[model samples]
Target: MKSNLFISALFALTISLASCNSSNAKPQKKVETEKPDSAATTKIQVALLLDTSNSMDGLIDQAKSRLWNIVNTLTTLKYDGKTPDIEISLYEYGNDGLSEKSNYIRQVTALSQDLDLISEKLFALRTNGGSEYCGAVIQDATKELKWSSENNSMKLIYIAENEGFNQGKINYKEAISDALKNDIYVNTIFCGNKTEGINIFWKDGADRGKGKYFNIDSDRAVQYIATPYDDEIAKCDEKINKTYINYGSKGLEKKRNQAVQDQNAKRVSASNYTDRAVSKSKAVYKNESWDLVDKVKNDANAIAKIQKEELPAELKDKSTAEIQAIVTEKKKERETIQKEISVLAKKRQQYIDTEAKKTKTQDDLGNTINSSIMAFAKVKGYTVEK
Candidate 1:
């Protein structure tokens, strides 16, 4: 009886211990659920390296009028109406060699927050010649703008010049390679009218640059990049966070960007003009000068008629006599007003070149930095995309 009683007590105590152990055991962890963050997904930077040259007037107009569309597209990206962070830049080509101020360049930089300055520069652009596409691309993708490796920002470039883009000193392949090294993507926007070979070359550039290549034959790139009609009021105007519309004219200050080095930016020769006088000065071309040339011809003819006529030798050509008489009168005038005018013309050209240098360089830098800012704004939580 005592043994049976002791066994019963032992069994009860063992069962109680097992029950306590089971109750005290910790439960398994449940898998954590998380909300999808667009910002966390991927950061993006897009540079619109457009051709702001002679044949791109229509293209320029489109970009100017519809910048908002691209902005609107970017606005659509948001977790709860808060946009993603983005950076957008703009560039132009086909204005080099002929004039210092007029050259290919990346105007806007890697940001999109300021649509106003982008609009101003886009509108300010006019057509010229010389397409240095590769040079500008390399400058923007690697040199000037601040790109972060930590954010995984998608650096993209769009080349939109009508001409074949081999003019810039850098090779197309090398430009794309530089871009790729920085993890930036470059997309080529070519018109359908471009040569097959040229188009193929761009395709190669874009592929190597690790970006999409688009061929739009029409002058509708701006419209194509637009958002639907319903989404107009997008980015907020926060000073700390940066919003569109207020990006104001900040893009005008990026003159020293590396991509700008290859551009024929106009420079003011600080040298003072020659205070000394001379009998003969070089003739420069101008519209008013052309008018002067015409007027001078008339004055010369009047002077010839007023002068005593000398009989020409029978063997001498009649045309020769007329030319000689004209030359003599021009020589006489060279010592007076004409000489002074010539000097003034040189001075005028010097001043003009200086201003041109400032304007063109400012314009180029303006476009590059502004475009870069826009690209940045798009990537940095704005729901806008272009």
Candidate 2:
């Protein structure tokens, strides 16, 4: 009888141990299941590396004129029916004003969502006499930028130069290979004849990096198509600017910069200015860091948490509820303005598209980048809304 009892006890002990192990494993499994998928929040990162040598002045001008158009194109993309975050980095190489130790390369902006800052830097670029080191600049961009690691994210590097691709100490082959390993495609844009570009290894760089190559007449000016709806869109832009409630330390400065960027776009051309206004109407033109309406949209309780001192002078004396009410009113006004602008923009685009079919215009910096982005985005399972 005692032997039987001892066997039963051993069986009971085994059951207890197994039960403990199962309970211990439950939490770990739960944790793993709850973990977020990094790929679900995909981003589109673009690096613009422009050769700012003396001969490439026209390239810079083209870039300045097309910044808003490129941005408007990017905002149309959706990943899995959701808009992905967009970031752009700028680099100026082959400028004598830049340090030789850095291979005449200056990172104008790190991969960022601040479109105004990108515009500011692009306009500030000035060409100077310097060696064009394509390989070194490519290597720098590949190594230095905080490129997205998600497999679904689109990472692109567009290097525009008129010089030989193999003009630096760093081999273009190795640099492009490293970029590919990081899932970054390096597109080469030669500002000259196609055959000469191919002979100078520009085509080879694109092929090896799994990107497109094109030769553009850099001296040619960007052409614009004016629409009847552009004047209404400009008026909407003015109204939308008034709806932004700037708060925080840099709020006023950023607000001023917004107007400055508007002026910059207008300085480019009436069509370019309309593009910027249309872009501001989209969801991607967020100014959450400074605009109270945007901040409150992301966080319902943000107004309550913000210190009075951080708020604009007009709102400093108001209570949290008052501030919230003001923000809500401004938000509604902005949305109305945005909707009006959106309608006008659609009409404007239709006009441009119809006009475009009538002329076979040569591709410029904006057209090349925009077309390539759509192609790359489709390959990565992103959809474009026409």
Candidate 3:
């Protein structure tokens, strides 16, 4: 009976050991699988908070004109020799059209990769008479948006306003401090005189946030320098547009909106239009939500997964293999067009740069934001490609 008891106890201990090993093994496997691939996971998040009160129409116009220019500038930055995904969020504060209960602020768009949607929202924004609340908007953006927690990711918030920095119930200092905790730097752009901006605590806000402070002439119009390559780039833009195959429920609508945005950019200036075209040639201007070519590029099985009803009329009757063939062809066509545009774009930029040397650099929304982006990116170990 003692020998029987000893064998039973030994069996129980063996089972316990097996159970513990099984449990430990799972967690170890989970950790291995869950480890993030930091090399491919870097991102750049930028939030633009613009005061859209009655006096800030020029600021709005500047934003509209320079949106593509800013995007093109951002495309030049790379982290660890790889280009990071760019996500932009927009906010409009001090607009009386917005709810006063929400401190006259509206989160226009959450941090998103949809460049077209951002352009559409920006174009829709209109100024109205309202009280400006810098601190409230900053605090709201910090808490509400889904900021990346990665230490290597570059996150920035640029708030442009002519009003006093210390406004509304929320304290700017505390708001900026909270932002800093999330690794977000809050830059301030004062749309008036430099001394006036400093006197009104704009500089202090930048200091507290550890970001750059700039005073821009928001009322001044953005000057465009036309180049000989603009016409060729425009032609390439038209050719690239043809390569997009619309799919999904919103595909057709989004395609129409893309054309509308093109018109909007053209209305700004020939140079602005060219800037938008150049941006479209870059990898950052992906429209996977609506474009089948882009969708298939991102997901190898996307063509097989797509429903026949969701495809465009021309593609709806095609078999899966046929559709795939078409997407492949379009992809190849797009790449070729994009390459042509890129070549022309280099020449266009060179001409513009040469012309720009004749004049003093204007401290406008685009220049200030672009310069600050370079400065901040360098500090974060990002390299700029020429």
The sequence of per-residue lDDT tens digits that candidate 1 reaches over residues 50-146 is 6756666666655553343344333334523444455567666666533444344645545553333454455556767665556555655567766
List runs of model 1 lying over 4 Å from the truth.
1-43, 78-82, 96-103, 106-112, 194-200, 218-386
lDDT of 3 at 374: 96
lDDT scores of the candidates, listed in order: 0.45, 0.92, 0.93
Q: What is the TM-score of each candidate against the true structure?
A: 0.45, 0.93, 0.93
Name model 2 segments beyond 4 Å from true: 1-29, 33-40
Q: Which wins on TM-score, candidate 1 or candidate 3?
A: 3
Better of 1 and 3 by lDDT: 3
Instruction: In angstroms, give how far residue 288 of model 2 lies from its true place.
Output: 1.0
Error of 3 at 137 (Å): 0.4
State the displacement of the C-alpha of residue 276, model 2, in Å, after optimal TM-score superposition: 0.5
Candidate 3 residue-wise lDDT, 300-379, digit = tens: 99999998899999988899999889899999999999999888988888898899999998889999999999999999
* Candidate 1, residue 324: lDDT: 49
RMSD values, in order shown: 29.1, 3.2, 3.3
